[model samples]
Target: MSKYLISIIGPTAIGKTALSIKLAQHFNTEIISADSRQFFKEMQIGTAAPTQAELAQAKHHFIHHKSVQDQYNVGAFERDALLCLDELFKNHNIVIMVGGSGLYVDAVTKGLDDFPDVDESIRKTLNQDLETKGLEHLQKQLEMLDPKSYGTIAIDNPHRVIRALEICIGTGKPYSSYLNKKNTNRPFKTITIGLHAERAIIYDRINQRVDMMVEEGLIDEVKALLPYQHLNALNTVGYKELFNYFSGAWTLDFAISEIKKNSRRFAKRQLTWFKKQEEAIWFDYLTPVDAIIKKVHSTINAEN
Candidate 1:
């Protein structure tokens, strides 16, 4: 049997975890999580990481395996996940890669595009602009510099917007110009499966997930990590909202509402990002496990 990487991708709160676990257990293989938010050990409730029972059902990697203080990025994850995959293929012909982080999954399947080294000064200036002039100013700047990226990338994410703006300003080109380059070939074949639901359903699920996170002590988790809230990894949806509450910028209720709203927006961005995966085969969120498993088996056999 040939080595195969089955990637389960979808928006947050879209049931990708359960589906991935089912597929992994069915294949008697392990799972590699590609969700960037769930990478930190300190962030459990906010990132919606799998429960202990979920982890025990099948072996998993890249969940809570890093510290928020560490400088982990997609490039590093690509290297690490590939090394992990190399080891897994030694014993199993099939492995599961699952997450909603489009870049991370693409790094393993198609590889990241190599961009020119951006100057530190450019980044510093952009950060300064973000701090002083607000994200709106930088967003407009990106719109003028790289409208394509401004359209496709998650512009609300300050880090993502800043990264794209820096590349555009430093390279004197649109950031999109550097994407979709020939992918680095991998030894194993990747079959991407996407999950989707009606927009209303996705939003409702996101709202409910945020409520569940709050009930699960996400506020306390943020409070415990208050000292390290300045870290880049901590600048995410759930934590950031609560951090604002701690700073007296927002009330607890307002903060929770923001988390829900931002989470819904994030899910929308995820759907937009995954749509760019041209090879992905999308399934309804409620699609039966047997049907998906059959599809996966056929894909593997066809590839072989």
Candidate 2:
């Protein structure tokens, strides 16, 4: 029998966790999480990690499995996830991978794009610029160096901006040139299932999720993680907004509003990213679980 990996991808709060759990139960296999933010052990309510009951329904890997202090990146996650999948495919013919982080999902299904080794000095210079000149300066620099990336990638993310600038500066070429390369061959076949909804519905879901997180102690979660706010792992949407509030930069109401707005924007970006996936099979977010299961099983049976 040919092994297969079913990837459940969608924007935040679009019922990915619920759907992934249901799918995992149906497949009688475990799940691998590609959601980068949920990997940190400290972030729960803000990252909207699976509830204890949901986790009990399915065995999951890479969720709350790392400390914020650890130097984790997509490269490290790729290596670790592949090893986990190797062990999983040993027993199960079908494994489920789910998350909103498109890059991490791509790393496992396809592979990381190749970029020439950049000079360390370039990164150091960029870091210095970020510290002294501020993020806007670097953002503008990326805009000038790689407008395509500025338009596509999360340019508001300092790490992404610095990465693009480093590559652009090191190779003297636009950073976007290194993206969307040929995927590496994999031992198992992958079936990508994308869940989507109307724009207004998605935004409403995002807003409701943000409110849910807040009521579930998202502020306290951020308060507890305040000491580690400087860490890259904490530089995320919900936590960052709360952190700003904690710092007196914004009121609690404003921070909560910002979280909702940023989450909506993030969802939009996710949709844009997933839309480029030519091989993806999409369904409305409200699609019946039985129907999706039938579709997946039929696809698997046909492939086998």
Candidate 3:
């Protein structure tokens, strides 16, 4: 049988995990998660990791696989995920990878370009700039230096903003210049599938999911990881909001509301990101998941 890497991608709170498990079970294979936030074990509730019973449904990899203190990025995830895929392909003809992270999904399927390592001084200077001049200062500078990156990247995200600027200043090139470079083919076939729902429905789901996380002790979970909030791994939506609240930046109610609002906005961004993918086949959330699994199976069978 020919080896295939099948990816299930969708917006946040759109039931990607549930659908992924069904597909993985149908293929009788393990799943490799591409959601970067789920890598940190300390972030289970907020990250909405699979429950214990769901884990028992099929083998999963890369979910809650790292510490908050550990540094992780797309580059690191690409290497680790490819290595794991190599091992999985030994026995399994089809391997499942699921997540909403667009870049991580792209990295494994289309190899990321070589990035120049930056000096510690780069981050140091960025931090000092963030402290003294503020993120707006860096944002304006990025606009002048790499307007292409500035157009798509999240200007409100300090880490993303800083990293883009770092690459621009360090390499004297636009950070987006390195991405979307056509590359050689991989050994195995890859099929990309996207899940989607109506915008109002998706936003409602996101709100409900945030409420579920709070019931699952998300506030306490965030408190536990507060010491490592500075880690790049914890710079995500749920974690960052709670951190600000703990730091007295806002009331807890306001922070919780912010998480819901930001998550909905994030879902919008995720949809926007997937729409740019020319290769993905999309299914609505109301579709029968098992039927979709059959559709995926036939697609893979034809490719095989």
Candidate 4:
């Protein structure tokens, strides 16, 4: 019997979590989250992580499993996630993986691209530049050095931008040049499902979600994490926007509006990355769960 990994991917607030839980329950399996932002234990409300009720409905792995102070990266996540999948596969032939982070999702489904290790000093210098010159400076550098990566990666993310710049400076090669070079074969087959909607609807959903987060104490959550706002994990959309407001750089209303705008942009980038997966089966955001299940079953049967 071949094992199967049902991967649920889509833009933020696109109902991936709900669909993943439904599929996991139907298959009597567990879920592995690939959302990088949801990994931090302190970032629950802002990340819109699974609620207590939703988590109780299905056994989930990798949610709130690490702290912002930890030095975790996608490479480490790939190794750990594969180990978790190995254990789960022994108990059930099917497992579910869900997230809006394209890089993390690809890390599990396809192996990460190999890059040569550069001197630690290179990263140190990049961090120094980020502190002195700001993320915009580094982003501009990447746009000049590796436009392809700049377009695909989360450009607004300082960690992502710095990672790309370090690679480019360390190896004297475009960061995009190192991607998609590895074709690792895994033990189980992957069944990717992407949920999508019209641009206006997606934007509206994101705006409403942001407003709900604020109502649910997102401001208080950000305030609690103010001490660790410098951590890479805290450099996310929801947190960073509020951080600006706390610094008196922007009004609360303006901060909330920025969060919505940034979130919508993040969703657009997510869609751009996920759409590149030509093998994925896409469905409307409102598609019936039963219909999707039938499609999954047929796909599995046909392959067998």
For model 4, residues 1-304, the per-residue Cα lDDT tens digits are 6899999999999999999999999999999999999999999999999999999999999999999999999999999999999999999999999999999999999999999998889899999998899889999999999998988899988888988989999999999999888999999999999999998999999999999999999999999999999888998999999999999999999999999999999999999899999899999999999999999999999998
Output the TM-score of candidate 4.
0.97
Candidate 1 lDDT (Cα, 0 to 1): 0.92
List the global CA lDDT of all models: 0.92, 0.91, 0.86, 0.95
- Candidate 1 backbone collisions, by pair: none
Per-residue lDDT, model 4, residue 67, is: 94
* Global Cα RMSD, each model: 1.3, 1.2, 2.3, 1.2
The true-versus-predicted C-alpha distance at residue 21 of model 4, in Å, is 0.6
TM-score of each: 0.97, 0.97, 0.90, 0.97
What does the lDDT come to for candidate 3?
0.86
- Residues 1-304, candidate 2, lDDT per residue (tens digit)? 8889999998888999999999999889999999999999899999999989999999999999999999999999999999999999999999999999988999999989999998899999999999999989998998898887776676657898899999999999999899888579999999999999999999998899899998899999999998998999888899889889999999999999999998888888788888888999999999999999999989988977
Relative to the unseen true structure, what is the C-alpha lDDT of residue 174 in candidate 2, on a scale of 0 to 100?
A: 95
Tens-digit per-residue lDDT, 1-304, candidate 1: 7789999999999999999899999999999999998999999999999999999998999999999999999999999999999999999999999998888888999999988898999999999999999999999999999887876776767999999999999999998899878579999988999999999999999999999988999989999999998788988889989999999999999999998898888888788888988899999999999999999989887866
